[model samples]
Target: MLIPSELVLSILSYCDGSTLATCQQVCRHWQTLIDHYDALVWSPCCERDFQKGLRRRFWSLDFPDPQMVDAAMLSSYAKPSTLWQSLYRITKHWSLGQCTTSFLTNYTLRQQKRRPCVVVGTTQEYNFFTSLSVAQSGHIVRSNPMYKGTTEGRQAMIVHASFDQDPTLSSFYLEDDALHGIVCHYSHPASPWIVTGGLDGTVSLWNEPERCVARTWQGHRGRVLCVSMNDQVVISGGSDSMIRVWDLDDAEQRGSIDISSYLSERHDWFQGVGEIALNGHLIVCAPDTSGPVLIFSLLTGSLVYELKTEPQDVAFTRLCLTPFYLLTKGEINPSNRNQVPIYPNTSSSSTPTVSSSPYSNTTNSGSSSLSSLSSLSSSTSTAISTYALAPPPSLSLTPYQLSRYYNLSSNNMTTFTAARSCIDVWDLQTGKLVYRLVPPLPATTTASITDIRISPNAAHVFACVEIRDNGSRRNELCYWDFSNHHTAAPSIMVLPSMTSSSFGNAWACFY
Candidate 1:
């Protein structure tokens, strides 16, 4: 019986790595079938490939997985010298790597180390936005403004900063003024929105998405960290260990739940809502509380499944509901805030406090298929592979466990720690820790990470920039774009390493 490739892919859920290798070899038709069904690939594979890139592991190899180190297609991965081979084609984190046509002999060692970046349409790269809040007034609230680089001795910039639009109106106003950005919500009844939990402790929301915040709540004693938005519901978590859900659809605090109360009941030191994962009508909030991620019917707002996290003490950072697995971000300390995670300090990173919760593997068929190919193909470039001095013992992490963790923290911190980074990514399908996307810093490691933001487009891409030490880097917005060539990391070719935030959320209205 001849099975159609598309039909085969249609029925079976693809896991990454070996699963994909097996499926693709079924027949030429299978290969062509899955090629078009790349969405079937697990989300974690993307995270893994990106991690390979940060560690410079992917540069010299064909596959992102270390298992491919001596595979039959080693030549197919990288030809001759490791510096110039590519097994997969990607359009993110736009950086200048190697060229097979020109001989390295023609250039000096320094030239080889130099990353090739050219200015394209825009030049203002600022920071990675943790929770991208587009206020109606064009004011932007940046989580942290820390950037590392040539400015090492300067004051540690706040990981949270606000961009001003108009003090009056509240709305996600798309305007074109040089000094203003979308900041607040419009007080008008027509449109209402609210921004909660930033690098700061403030929690506020407006009645309209295009209007100013009509109410601001300051119940949490700590910084309001992460935020989630759905129909008319806005959920926020913070260092205070509280998960408060606000019904924005109504003009009142229609419904609310306290994560702190649950934490106090459990007698845990850090029992609060660190992050929230949302699916259609279901909501799962990760907390220090001992249970599977707290799941509830998002619309009904009632308790649902409490899947045990298993024996591992893994806390989720990010979660999404779709064809992908129930995803979660890696566990990082709330205070572990250097703001920029360009690379994993595998050598010195502390072993995460193992959780008593049992973690169910989240990898599924759809996400695994895509996850396999990307994971098999990408790694970090040559320049990032080796370093003269490893980070201090306090910051080092083991390379072997790179694929084991996922971090939901931002990579754009504004501190002076050498080991901390701002960027972290995860596989949305399998809940596997894939990679850490660190902002590209200079040789001196001067600027710390500031804020981070991912492209809202179809492509899963994000960007990070260093803080502005002087007035050198300003007038900014976001980093990646899917507009042309369907490329991520568009700023890698068009702007400096850091991005600017002079514009609002879409960053369309540049200052």
Candidate 2:
């Protein structure tokens, strides 16, 4: 016999995939329940017809989904029916192979001929957006999500940005140096950053970059390969063969001795310094293949430990500290597939002209080596302190290795090893290797793991393999949930098409 209706309704509420579809067609009451429940509780994109129903019945104001309309119609007066317009405006022109989440104050590069600097914010009533960061060129703009045709609705706002305040400009301790591309951390929402890796091979620190430089650090000599900071301190690595650490509070040299000065003078280029993690006594750096990250004794600047990489042409490409600061939020718009991420771009609602970078000029300076640490001196350290010694290089390992963090889930850990396509996974707590979760493809499938990226929230991790179809380079993403990873393999999720600018790539935010 068929199940009772109330019991079935209760069970169906939690049902998903095809099972729920089958239940809905069982009876008249079942159909009504399915339709009504879908519109009210299920996600807005769940029903095919419900979205069409929204435009005619709900949004008296006109809004259209950018995905459905051409660019010509995006600015046209023809408004979509109410139900879907709001959702459509929130999510349009999202792209694949990119990941996004709710970490507030991030900039979303919306549709534009050039890379557009778009600000995203939130408020109780609706979302707010200004014109794209205008350059010398004319400005491109999107209608305020809450822009009411009437004056009354104009005042009613929903989404809003954090940096509406007029921040006073100030000079920084850092000097005017050549700049590589900018990499910033918006983690400390109150005190954001514009950490620049310099061409003169120095690192400069800027406070929330509205109008001034907060602090400048003149440390590295070669191109500053990477820079990452957190609540506790500012860390930088460069081609100068050193990774320096600075105190965040007053930008003081941490610990008793200034390790920042002692080590940077030793190597030729510290190239890719991977993510950094400060664990009580150990300051760790995971870097590209150049050398082992100098884990100095934060207490003495003495090299305490080393996180070695597989010996290869590896400098760290990206380095995040131990704490995975997850910026997460829900995707309100289905087609958009990503919520507007927050960026702490502090400027005059204007985009700055970006160039190929200062390092582009110095990259060909040729390989040069330093003499010795005989002159390496900490103002606080006497010659006796200089003799204390650096960490002895790795025992059997070759010069430094090319080790990259391949995949990290809430449930598993994976790393790229020496064997080209090989990646290893381990248990998060025990550090015991979890061999089952490794990539199932043959070792010959990929040239390298350059396309691997983990979602900021750690819910999903994606890796794009270097496989080719015809003459075109075609890579596919393998997505696995952080929670169920130990028992699960990633399902392959791909871009619908090259032209598909659907919200952030193969990942979604959930918090």
| Best by the lDDT measure | 1
| Candidate 2 TM-score, true structure as reference | 0.37
TM of each candidate vs. truth: 0.39, 0.37
Give residue 1's error in model 1 in angstroms.
8.2
Among all candidates shown, the one with the greatest TM-score = 1
lDDT of each: 0.34, 0.31
lDDT of 2 at 88: 22
lDDT of 1 by residue, 451-508 (tens): 3332221122233233333433332322322112222122121111224453221232
User: Cα RMSDs of all predictions?
Assistant: 15.6, 24.2
Candidate 1's displacement at residue 50, Å, is 17
Candidate 2 structure quality by residue, lDDT tens digits, 1-511: 8667677657665542234344545678876665555423223332321122212221111222333322222222123222222222122101000111111112222232331122121111122211111111111111222333233222111112212121332112222322332332222222345455555655566543332356766666566655555456776766554667777667564532223443343344434453454433345555434443444545455654333323323333222221112111111112221212111111222211112111112112221111110111101100100001011111211244312222212223322222233222221112222221122233334333322344222234444333432444433344333221122232121212112222222211111
**How high is the lDDT of residue 103 in model 1?**
8
Off by over 4 Å in 2: 1-191, 208-212, 255-282, 286-444, 451-457, 485-511
Error of 2 at 158 (Å): 26
